[model samples]
Target chain A: MLDLFIDLSLFTMLVATGFAIVKMRRLFGVTMMTGVFSLLSAMLLVTLDAVDVAFTEAAVGAGISTVLMLSTLTLTSRIEKSPVHTPWIPLLVVAVTGAVIIYGTLDMPNFGDANAPAQVGVAAQYMERGPEDMDLPNTVTYILASYRGYDTMGETSVVFTAGVGVLMLISGLRRRRRRKPSRDEGEVS
Target chain B: MPEIEYILGHLNYWLFTVLMMTGLYIVVAKGNLIKKIVGLNLFQSAVFMFYISLGKITGGTAPIFPLDMRIDPATVYTNPLPHVLILTGIVVGIATTSLGLALIVRIREEYNTIEEDEILGIEKELVAQENRTLGDAMGGRA
Candidate 1:
């Protein structure tokens, strides 16, 4: 019963935060609300027994992402200009998409059903073998570091590429350095 | 009672759907590029929630086992695969967010405005001018 209450309240806060993010025009408030939304979702993940995910969400979503957004705000405008187009079209689109998803969920297993397809299959093997293989308590760590090492490596490379891309986009290559010196020499002459 | 049970059982998914749609609305309806990015984050987080929720077992504990090598056959553990997958996803999401903000900064610098409509207007004028000059040189081919 307590679990249900916690789940309900956290979800309520999440929806409220989502609405607040959409309704607010001030960019700063929206950004902070986004962090709050992440934190709320992190809590929800915790209740769902996703402690590692909760940790990462709280750190990356609420911590690093919020700082990055704030710094971006400093570089950009803090107030969003009111949208010129009527929101009715977007509303209709979102509503239809959401309705379809809800309809699809009707065929899905009930929440926390042990017999759900996701809980069976290879997941059972991992849960069985994780401790025996790695001698570690955390199955997530064992699977991430050992079973899915290549994927993590690829993810690391992606982060590296993103960093390089951001650096290039923001700072750019100094293509005119030689020309600048020649122009200065001409001026001196 | 069956209907109530159904609603309660599926409540998480319903709420997640609502959150996801709200994010989609912001992305589609809002003009500000940064606001759109914020919406994208919200949307990504909602999807993460959906995946994590899928891993839950009715009476499962967190996916960590006991450190002392004590194996309890009766104890249930939540699925850890989704958590592993979403860990990578969250990292990638942050990377995307940063890269997007960098692009936005460049766009702001070039156009001196981030409003999508204004940018479109400027581009339209530029294209028209180019057609007037270059097209005339090509005997109005363009």
Candidate 2:
């Protein structure tokens, strides 16, 4: 019962935050609300027994992303320009997509059903052999570092690529500006 | 009673749909690039929630085994595969967010604006000028 209540309340907060983010025109408020939204989802993850995910979400979603957004805001405009196009088309599109998803979910396994397909298959083997294979206290850590090491390596490379891409995107402009003493350079400096 | 049970049982999935759609709406409807990125993050997070919820087992505990290496045969661990997948996903999400913001910064530097419509207008004007110059050069045949 308590679990249900927590889940319901967190879901409520999440939806409210989403609405608030949509309604707010101020970029700063929206960014902060995004962090709040992440934190709320992290809490929900915790209730779903996803401690590792909750931890990562709290750190990345709520912490690093918020700081990055704030810095970006400092570099750009804090106020959003009102959209010139009518929102009706987007609204209609979203409603139809959402309805389809809800319809699809009708045949899905009930929440927390042990016999759900996701709970079986390879997952059972991991839970079964995790101790014998890795002997790690955290099954998530064991699987992430051992069974899925290659995937983790790829994810790390992706992070590295993103870092390099950001460096090139942001700093490459400065190198170009230095090459030409033009009006654009003057404005940038 | 069955109706209430059905609703209660499917509550999480229903809410996930709502949150996912809200994110999609923001991405589609918002004009600001930064707002769109935020919406994209929201959308990604909603998907993460859905996956994590799918891995939940009614009576399962967090997937951490005891440190003593003592195996409890009856222990039910929530599926850890999704957790592992989502960990990678969260890392990727932050990477995408940072890369997007970097691009936004560059766009602002070049165009002095990030409003999608204004950028489109600038591009349209540039294309028209290019076509006029090229069309006249080939004018008539070249």
lDDT of 1 by residue, B11-54 (tens): 88998999899899999999999999999999999999999999
Q: What is the TM-score (0 to 1) of candidate 2?
A: 0.94
What is the alpha-carbon RMSD of candidate 2 to the true structure?
2.5
Tell me the tens digit of each residue's lDDT in model 1 across A138-179.
Answer: 899989999999999999999999999999887742444346
Error of 1 at A39 (Å): 1.0
Tell me each candidate's TM-score.
0.93, 0.94
Candidate 2 lDDT over A108-187, as tens digits, reads: 88888899888889989988888888778998998999999999999999999999999988886767667657865679
Q: What is the TM-score of chain A, computed separately for every candidate? A: 0.89, 0.92
In model 1, the runs with Cα more than 4 Å from the true position are A172-189, B136-142
The DockQ assigned to candidate 2 is 0.89
* A58 Cα displacement, candidate 1 (Å): 0.7
- Largest TM-score belongs to which candidate? 2
